[model samples]
Target chain A: MGELEKIREARKKWQEKYEKSCTERDALFQSISGVPVKPLYTPEDAEGLDYLRDLGLPGEYPFTRGVRQNMYRGRLWTMRLFSGLGTAMDSNRRYHFLLDHGTTGLSVAFHMPTIMGVDSDNPRARGEVGRCGVAIDSLEDMEVLFDGIPLEKVSTSMTINAPAAILLALYIGVAEKQGVGPDKITGTIQNDILKEYIAQKSWIFPPEPSMRIITDILAFCSEHVPRWNTISISGYHIREAGSTAAQELAFTLADGLAYVEAGVKAGLDVDAFAPRLSFFFDAHLDFFEEIAKFRAARRIWAREMKERFKAKKTESLLLRFHTQTAGCSLTAQQPENNIVRTAFEALSGVLGGTQSLHTNSMDETLALPSEKAAQIALRTQQIIAFESGAADTIDPLAGSYYVESLTDRLEKQAYEYFERIEKLGGVVKAIERGFFQKEISDAAYRYQKEIEQKKRIIVGVNDYVVENEKVEIPVLVIDPEVERIQVARVKALREKRDNDAVKRRLEELKKAAAGSENLMAPILEASRAYATLGEIVDVLKSVFGEFKEIPVF
Target chain B: MERKVRVLVGKPGLDGHDRGAKVVASALRDAGMEVIYTGLHQTPEMIVEAAVQEDVDVVGLSILSGAHMALFPRVLELLKEKGVDDVLVTGGGIIPESDMEKLGKLGVGKLFGPGAPTGEIADYIREWFKSSSRAKG
Candidate 1:
């Protein structure tokens, strides 16, 4: 008999003997994404996995093993903390503090005003300025944000979507003042607008204009900011929006493919832009499933880039990503337990061969990470890198029977979603049809039902009873004074800067935005002339028009 | 025939974390309540207008952005100004216990935090509707 037939025969016999004596628990035996999980997985489970075709060696075509050959053995993944909070100076201080304590890279978390492309003084921005992240209104705020730190040295990642071009211009403006050229500046802009429509809901312009802005960035960055990652096509928000793992994988890759098509149609070479493209994903609580998802993501992205886009460069085919421990997985009840949760998630990211990582702080469920909690969060990553021996090898869980089988299953599920999305026109049209939104909502509701039905047990919440559990962890409170300071600063900037120059630059931007021109130059000019983010966004909003979602539940 | 408890689920401010709000909204709908969801980025004025227009009996404002202290009270004040005083004002997010108490004193109903069950939220709205003056009438 063949080896596979022998294993199947043995497995059937074992199951038959064990089934009568051992009954399964009365619970849902499924992955978090609802993929059914059997009690045992053997060699037969990985029967169809062709080693070379499905998963090549590290750093090869169809990179399911790891993107880099040596992975963490050569250089450890960048420990970037997604932080910001209050004024530019305040966030700058936090940056220095983080840098001092082993954080390798900087990920700026802009406040709602900045993210929404509004100024602090805007009435819509009231009560929200500097509440969640640092408020950057102009190049002045950006300069203060990077005051002591040199842009040429440390890599920065800005989490800005809608007004991503404006923020990128501001960063370039700051780099110029620091005597650093655009070529020398290295960073990433979360310039992903498609996901904003699908999940994050921070969109400004409608889909067409938004894609135009993104392609413009792609074209400009390929020529000038070659070292910069123009867009970090993200699945973090989609998963955080309560999408199943399959949905996150499929939707994110679909968005990536859409961007490639947009760039190609706009007369840009796929190789020139695709190499600079990056991704960001969430490392949720599902241990092996998260690992499988990451492996599958690398494989699918590699195949799609090569087969569909005909990306010739190896760098273009390789999928590089940053992973953040899921914030949605944290709990307000027994907040400290979140530390353990984050550590495990971060470990999965490492084992799955992430290029960069951000671990959530324990107190994040209740408030922003307090100083102590942020320190502990940073320490958690350090412990994993050093103490846990998790980073000693690359793609450590690549060949396990259950993991390989789950990876194949996730890959198949993602392909099924891809077909459905294609059937509904594409990602943008599917979004308009509320296809992705409805799927996510249904999955979210199902997960909630499971918890409520006592099928799933969440420690410290549904199952673990803690009577009058007093949260002892310190929560960071954003002082209301931060808003006052930011509002005053933006007002002062408008007063001090050359109004006529700002007006001329903004007019140039408005005109450029109206025509079929690369917007980066005009936007960079506006940023250099001290134009506010809100002013820039307002100009484009007038030309491109705003997007209003139909609000799917 | 009985009147279904009417609830307006509002996402105030710019924070787009609507997983909790949407889950609770559908759960309320499943529980046989009339739910009017005012979608993302609804200002206090927009929320109050929707509440009065929908004639909702309960207004649940979900603000995960730390703007709750500023947003929650403004919503209450707007509802009062609109002469829509009968509706209940309650919501959930990453609100501290101290802030919840302060909002409670200012006429906001019992506020929930993270990890709160959807069933718990539905129960709270149902109990509030049962004891409310609208139910008595």
Candidate 2:
């Protein structure tokens, strides 16, 4: 008999025997995304295997297996623990400490006030200044935040959304002050405003203007900051908001497609800005499933960029991504167990060939990670990079029948979602109708229900109950003094800065906002004048108006 | 006709972490209560104004930015000044034990922590409602 016929006969015989002999926990089994999981997989599971077309070589067309040809052998993935807390000066200390501890890249975590586009002294910003991250009020604080750090050397990623333009201006302003050219500075801005409306809820401007701002940044960054990644289209927050892996993949890629479409409509070449496009995914505890999701993400992005968007450049076709260990998966009870959970998640990111990664600290479920927990989180990445031989090979699980099946299935589901979204008139319209939000919320409710009923085990949470579990881990406390110090500094900045220059720049910004002109240059000019983040944001808000969310549930 | 239990879920201050708050709001809505969620970056005053306008029987403030010390007391004070004393002011989010005690002393209701179940939160609000003046005929 032919090999194919023999395999078919064996599979049929096995199925017949397994139907009667197989003992199972329940009737059905599936991954977190509800893709069915099989007991044992043979050649039948990996039915359609066109080696080159399905998953090209690591760096070849489609770039499915890995982004680069050499992968980790070329260089280890950047270990960037998203660290920032207290004042700019305080966070600067933490940055230096992290750098000294061998973090490959720097990621600034803006305080809640800063992220919301509010000054430290704003009444709404009271008590929140520098609580969650560094308080960046103006260019002065930005300079202090990067005091000794050279912008030309280290690749920094800023986790900012709604006011991404303002933050980018600040970064460029600081780089200029350091005598570094725009081309010399390399980094990424999480300029994904779509997810804000969909999940995170940190949105400022309404959607149309927000897309306008994104396209404007894309244009400006393409021309000026050639080396900078204009946007990090993020699924991290989507998954954190409780999206299924497929939903996270689909929604995020859909957002990327929408952004590319907007840029094209804005009269920019797709290849020019597409090469700078990057993705951010969440590495959850579903180890192999997360790996499959990552692989699927690469294949999908490569095919869609080359096919749908017709992106010509091979660089534009490459799907580079950063993975962050899931924060939502962290539990407060027996928080120490979070360390192990994070290590596993980080391994998934590394094995899945992430370009950069952020491993969450154990105590993050309670507060911002303490210094020790932050180090452990950083060490988690380092150990994966050096000790664990997981990264020694590219796409280690490439040929696994189960993994390939999961990847193929996830790819199919993602396409199905793309069709559904297209039917809804694209992402923005879908978002307006709360389609993405509804999907995430439904998934979230199901996941929560599963845990509540013990259908899912969350270690210390749903199963292996630990009563009176003392959380002895050290928690980082943002001192009341941090707020006091930050408030006074901003109040003083308002007094010392060139008020007339700030006013003129802000007025110019308002004019630019009112018009169809790109606002990046005007905002950069405002940053040069040392206008506070709140001032620039308010000037734009005066014209663009704030977004009021249509609650999904 | 029975009056529905009205809850205003407020995210006071600048914290944008509202996953827990949204989950709880959904839970309350699922539990047959009227839930009005004050979206992110709400000032304590704004939350109180929302509470007064919405005529909510309960105000659940969610603050994760470690600003509860300044925000919670302000919300409580604003509720009192608005002569809305009968309304319950409770909250959760990274609030250490000591602050929860202080907040409790300041007349805030039960403060749920990280692992606190949504069902228990719903029950607490329901129990408070049963004994509340609104529940009395």
Candidate 3:
């Protein structure tokens, strides 16, 4: 009490001095989620917050500090650079480069042709082969994608959701070629299709079928690929789609909770599969706000996993996430300024103790990052980890009056969102009724209005007087011939494979998809038989049918 | 007769990121146009056929997969082959400058880069049709 009184007196003295200087400064100092700022925190702030219950020791229950006890001290977070562009071989070269340059893991990004379940030669897949990311038309392209990379030793993350089961099957098939059984491989698939519907909108089938496909992967992976994360419930794209940090946190956790309920409903034990359930958060430009968001996300997810779902294992309560710098924050105008923006975002992720980080290139808002830009982006992380002293401490701002208060506030606000969502009949109903969509739309509209009104000043965009700063960095340009080369490769591979065998596999896939049988096995067999993405998707499309977007506005 | 300017907005290939396509659909609809957003993952054949079946005057393809170089020309070639010449074709997403130029040459009416205002795009569509109409008359 004496120590608390002394601290309170000191805080009161400073607050009185500061309050005299600026009348509204105290209130204005609050975090962006509209949480209030407090002058000082005593034990009173953490009242009833049992150490074991609220902020458990790292690697223990609740996992408030982190998933691992030693954290980065045990092993540095995976420095995975999410990159893929221009043909499989080209992306393969980049993968080798990233690994050579000390990337701990590989996160493969696919081109649209591959993402949409189309082969390169498909008329719709034209011009797009190997553009944004690597194009994997069949198991052949997947093989080229991992040409020399060891499947057994190195972990891989594929950012494919709509075709996640298909892609996972392809990767496992690739591993099989490398003589590594599915059990030996370690990686994650961004198989969180619900977020795809609510935010990213890259969904293949309707929600029911999509959830079924995801559960099938979860069921299969739990039995076989125990080390692999079946689904990386992502808030990255949600934030990029114009959600506030609080919305990202709430929506992502809600999606995760929904997934747990889905797994449980699908006749799987929560502890068995919940251990592999991971999260992906977006590290936006708001430094302290982003950090608060991450901390709050961890606390909320832990509480929900334990209290709501009654998850027993410590792993079930832990929210291990990978952070990607916000691509939406980068501006095409004065694009070079994006470097600083990305640096701040990366620092936020680091300070928040992310398990893995991917920083965006300055030129990303312009086109896919060129080699020089990608290198610069990677070097940003390197400089932050090595040169910057930020990483020396875990949760560096843990006890900050502002950060802790905001973390608590964000956790509270997210619960409010969960309650509101529950009232609106949970995430699925909210999505169907366009509640989440409308809320995000309103938030996006508000943010845009603020920017336009100069209420929110983006340095080069508004307030800062950079008139005509020429972007000097070399933008990576993919050769037009890459498309020709990719198309030819798909054509050649299709011709070389056993046509009848492929057809049989495709028919089996259609049959399995049409029926109640798990689609993953047949899809894997199809991939093994050299079935193209278009061929496989066509089978599903014929059976499950295409998704027709309903106008919500 | 005032023919409705029906636009088919599509995201082709495997990239399921459709924020742009959805936003543009909303904007176009707000601008007094009928927008058919053929959700994520449409094939070129599928998109072209939708355009024809819906009798859309514009087919806007929003591709974030960077597969435009491979897929855009094929869509255009398919549209031309299907004898759908009067359709105002456009594409958007993360397109490099060189690729944008190449796509324009291939009869993609416009390439809308990031941060290009929706109002500006709507205006461009209006102006393009006006000039074309004038030239024909």
Candidate 4:
């Protein structure tokens, strides 16, 4: 008899073996994704699944076990802290601090204005010049952001969408000044605009023009910047926008499929751009579920890329991703508990075989992370990596009954979502009809309702309630003068630069935006001329028009 | 006959972090308030115009980019320009305690912070209606 049949025979004695063993009280009895958890998962659960076909060796087909053979034994996952707040100088200082303290990579969080393609002095950007992240108004701001750092040596990921193309142009212009070639500069642009329409909502142009810009970057990057990841198709914001883990997995992969289809239809070879594609997933508070999510994400991507897209490249089938601990999981009442919460989420990312990870600062729930809090968050990852022995093995939870069951369950649910989205005429058309937004809103509402009704126990929130809580953690305050300084600095840059050259470059960009020319070359020219982000975006807005979201609630 | 509370939830300026705003909008609607959410990138003028045209009883501006200081006052000024005095201009975000006090003195109503219960926000609006409308009558 098979091992499953043997376990089933033993399972028949559950009343004698387990049920009478202990009396249980109220338990949640389910995963956060609403998957029911059984008291025990035996070999009978994994019954008809073939080992080699379903779970191959590391770095092989259907990479469910692990992405690389050696995994962290060969090298640890990149410790990338999402650092940036205040002026370019302040953000630059933080970057230096993180790098000095042994962070392997850098992730930039652009300010609200910069992310939305607005300049520092714009009326809409008055008190928000450098609030959330580094304020990169022009190439000058980007220059100060990377003043002493070597462009080719350290990989950097900039978290900016809607205006990702312009930011990439500025970074390339800076690398050119450093004499670093495009191929040598490696990083990613969170150039996932479909998610913008679906979740984040900082989109500039309508979907059609936005997809055009994405394909243009794919074409340009494949030829020139081979190492640069043109897009990090994100589910981070989707989860933040109120998706369950399964929904986050499904919608993000669906968006990735949309980008692949877009690239192919743009007359580009799937292999050329697909090999450079990457993913970004969020690690919520769910421990085993997150690990299962990362595992299931890999298997689905590998199978679909091979069978569905029929891509011929090995690298094209890998679903390498970056994981950031969930910001939504942090609560302001007992902010310090966030440290413990973040550490577990980070460990899940490691066990899930993330290519890179960013553990959120404890103080993020209140404001931008304080410097000490940022250090603590970094140390959380380091301790897990070095001391805990988590990174010592590959797929340590592979044979676990519960984990494997959850992985299969999540993969099945994701396919159901894909079918639903395809029936609604794929992601773009589904988005146009407010399908993604409504689904996310419903999930978010349900989660909040669960908390309100005390169905879910959030330790600091509803369970161990604290009244009149005094949160004594240091909050990083961005000096109001930073705004005045950034505004004046951008105005000075405008006056100092050659007005004629700036005008000519912007006009050339506008012409390119209107015509069928690839936008990168002209945008790079404008960046070299020190044209501001708002100026460059205004040129495109004139031709492409700004996108106003269709409100969904 | 009783009237439904009408609240206009607006995200002014370039801050696109609307999770709080959207969640609050849904909660208010669930609480039986008519909600008009002006989806992202609305200028102060556009937001006030929508509030006035919709004839909302309350205008809740949600901002997290630390731009509340510049934005809240401008919305108040625009409402004054249109002489919409009866409309309440309450707000919330990651505003510092000091800034929250400053906004209160500038004629904005109570400001909520992160993790402030949605039920509390709904109750505050309901409480405001009883006192203010009763006074007008």
Candidate 5:
């Protein structure tokens, strides 16, 4: 008999003997995303996987292994912890602390007022100023945010959308003040507006204008800020919003394709902007499945870019991503248990060949990470990078039969989703028709039911049976004084700055926004005049109306 | 026939973490209650007005932005000012146990935290509805 047939016969004989001798657990064996998990995988499972065709060498065409040739052997993945809270000064102190503790990059989280494009003094901003993140209303806040930290040295990732342009302009303005030009600054903006409409629900304008703004950013960044990652097409929020792994993979790639199409239609070269594009994904539970999802993501993206968009540059075809341990996986019952969950998820990201990572703190489910908890989270990554030996090799899980099989399955599932989305017109139309929203809601509800029905086990919740558990971890508390201080600072800036210059710049911005002009220049001009985020957003909102979602449950 | 338990699920403030809210809403619907979901970005005034207009017996406010302390009291005060005393205000988010107790002391119903079972929320509402004067009437 042939080797393959011999293995298949042996596997069948073993399964029959095993089944007769020992009964398996009386439960459905499946992945977190509902994919069936078989007992044993062998060479038969990887029957037709063409290693050379499907997964070439690291950094080669169809980069299913790793994006870089040497991978972490050349340089370790960046430990960029997402941190921001209270005022700019407060967050700045935390940044210095992180830097002192060996953090490689900076990630900023803006408060809701700043994120929603509202000034601290706006009535809508009441009770929310500096609550979730640092409140930056003008260039002044940005400057203070990077007070002693040099912009040229550390690459910053700002978690802001809808008002992403204004925030980017403010960062540029600050860089100029530090005598650093746009070319000298390097970082990424989560300028992914599509996911905002789909999951995050923090959208400012409708789809048409939002895409326009994104394309403008793409165009300008390709010319001026070549080192900057113009857009981090994100699947983090989609997964966080209760999407299945396949849905997150499919929808995120779909969004990336839509952005590529938008850029091409805007008359920009795909190779120019596509190379600068990046991705963000959530490293959730389901250890091997998460690894498979990452591997599949790279292969699918490279194939799509090469075949569909005709991307010529090798860089344009490469899929570089930042992974964050899933925040939704954290539990509040026994908070310390979250540390272990985050560590495992972080390990998955490492083995999946992530370029950057952010491990969630143990106290995050209750509040913003306290100082001690943030340190522990950072230490978790350090341990993985140095101690766990995960980063010692590239794509270490590449040829495993189960992993290879799962990767193929996920890639097939993602392509199927892409076809369904195409049939429904496109991503924006699908979003408008509530297709993505309904699918995610159903998945989320199903997962919840699984937990309630004892089908899935989440330790410390629903199963471990810890009654009268007292959470002893210290949670971060945002002082009420921070809001007062932020509101007063924005008010004082309004009084101190040149109001006429601000008005003139805003009017110029409105005119540029009305015309088909690249908005970065005018927005930077407004930022130079210390225009508040609310003012800049108001001007854009006048030209481009706000988006109201068709609420779906 | 007994009147269906009417619940107005309100997402107040600016944060967009609505997975919990939507799950609870669907669970309530599955539990055979009348659920009116006021989508995203509803202020306190808007939520109260919807409750009064819909004549909802319970108003469940989901605030994850840490603005619950400021928002919950505002909704309760507005409901009282509008002379809607029969309505119950309860919801869940990333609220701490201490804060939940404080809100409870402020006359709000029992608040839940993360990882809470939807069935428990439904049971809480049903039990409250049974004891509430609306059920006796």
Candidate 6:
């Protein structure tokens, strides 16, 4: 027999033993996402695999390895701790602290009221101002958010979906104040509204108008900023909302495809803004599966952007993403164990070659992270980059027989998801018909059942028993005075601003919103005119009114 | 025979994140409770109006954007003024326990933390209703 045949025979012999042994040990026979674990992978599993066509080199086409050459070796992945809860000034201080502690970027979290486009003093926004995230009632709050931080230096990511364009305009207005033109600023707004209808549910207007707003932002960003990411298409919230890995990949990429179509319909070229269109994914506790999902996402996006979307540039194909450790995996019982879970998830993000990463604080399962807990989260990333030696190589797990097979399988599964969504008439249509909602509901039900039945064990929750151990972690409490001070400030600002100018700007804003003009420019103008968020939203509401989601199930 | 407890799950204010509200609603329904979801973007007045109109035994408000401090008190106040003081008011979200305690003092029945099981929430509602019925009797 030939040398190759002899080696193949030996591998097959080992595989037979492995399959027999798998019958003995049931643990290796299953995966978290419910995919069955096979005994062995071979050249047969990777049949018809063209390395150049499928797995190209780092920084090349089909960027499944890494988006850039010398990814972390060039410079470590941006450590963006998702911070922003309470007043804008409070969040701004946290931003400076993160940047000072070697963070490469900023991720803004908005409060619920702000997310809904309500002003701080609005009866609706009363207690919510600066609660879950930084409150931005007007341009003043935006200016306070980026106080000393130069907009030209570090990248900032805002996690605002429904009011994304308004917030983006506020961000641009803030940058312009610093004498930096649109071309000099680089960052992303989580402006994905389709996913809002699918999973997150932070939607404002109806689907038709919401898509128009997204396209308007895409068009504006493509023409002006050029470097700023118009939309960070997100799957993080979807997974956190109870989607399995395949659902996350499929639903997220479907949303991406919908955005591309919307941009194209908006008279924008595919290559113009495709490079700046980024993604945000969740790094769950399932190690290899998460890594495989990331790899599959890159490969699928690259292939679709090239062949399907007819993109010419390699940058147009790469899916540069920011990953946050799964908050759902953390437990309030033994909060300390969350640190370990976050570390593993962060490691998975690094291995998956995330362009940037956010290691969730251990206290996240409870409240917003205290400064001390936030520091430990940052240190987790630092240890991975500086100490663990995991960042030393590009795509360290690239050639693993199991990993490659899993990546291929996940890619195939995601394609199946795409087909199913397409059959249901694309993402928006599917969401309207409650397709994605039903899938996620079923997945969540199954996962919850698994936990209840002890089939899937969460340490400290379902399996490991810790009795009456008092946690001594110092929890940060936002002073109740924050609400009192915020109310007073808004009251003062309302008293100071010109009522006539505010009314006039709002009228113009309503008129613009009523027509086909981009509401973002008006929102910015209104903000400059010292318009409060509620005032701007109230104007739009006068025209567009409030969105009422008809719950399907 | 006792009537099945009916609870209304509502998202008040502008916060649009409804995954938690939907999940809790489903869990409540699964636990043999009649759930009237008020959909999204409900104002405090609208929620109270719905609670009275729907004639629910309980009103459960879910908000993840941390607006419960202001919004919860308003909802509770509206319920009292509307002469629906017997209608149990509960909250579920990322509320700090201390705030929950403060809210409790203001007559917010209970606060369910993250990962709280559906059965526990259902049981709490049942017990509250049972006690209310006994007092009325």
Query: Could you tell me which residue pairs clash in candidate 2?
Result: none
lDDT of 5 by residue, A268-308 (tens): 99999999999999999999999999999999999999999
User: Weakest 10 consecutive residues, lDDT, candidate 5 chain A?
Assistant: A22-31
Cand. 6 TM to true fold: 0.93
Candidate number with greatest DockQ: 1
Runs in model 3 lying further than 4 Å from the true structure: A1-52, B1-63, B67-92, B97-112, B116-137
Give lDDT for model 6: 0.84
Candidate 5 regions exceeding 4 Å error are none
lDDT of 4 by residue, A367-460 (tens): 8999899999999999999999999989899878888888998999999999999999999999989998999888888888778877788888
Better-scoring candidate (TM-score), 1 or 6: 1
Q: How well is candidate 6 docked (DockQ)?
A: 0.54
* Per-residue accuracy of model 1 over B1-137 as CA lDDT, tens digit each: 66999999999999888888999999999999998898899999999998998888999989888998999999999988988888999999989999999999999998988888888888988888888899966
> TM-score, each model?
0.99, 0.97, 0.87, 0.97, 0.99, 0.93
lDDT of 6 by residue, A129-216 (tens): 6767877888888899999999899889999877887788788889999999988898889999888887788776788878887888
TM-score of chain A of each: 0.99, 0.98, 0.94, 0.98, 0.99, 0.95
CA deviation > 4 Å runs, candidate 4? A15-23, B134-137
Task: Find the candidate with the highest lDDT and give its number.
Answer: 5
Off by over 4 Å in 6: A1-29, A39-44, A498-504, A518-520, B126-137
- As a whole number from 0 to 100, the lDDT of residue A73 in candidate 6 is 89
DockQ of each: 0.83, 0.64, 0.40, 0.73, 0.82, 0.54
Q: What lDDT would candidate 3 get against the real structure?
A: 0.82
What are the interface RMSDs of all the models? 0.8, 1.6, 2.8, 1.2, 0.8, 1.9
Query: Candidate 1: where is the Cα deviation over 4 Å?
Result: none
| Share of reference contacts found in each model | 0.74, 0.57, 0.58, 0.70, 0.69, 0.56
Tens digits of per-residue lDDT, candidate 3, A253-288, equal: 999999999999999999999999888999987788
lDDT of 1: 0.92
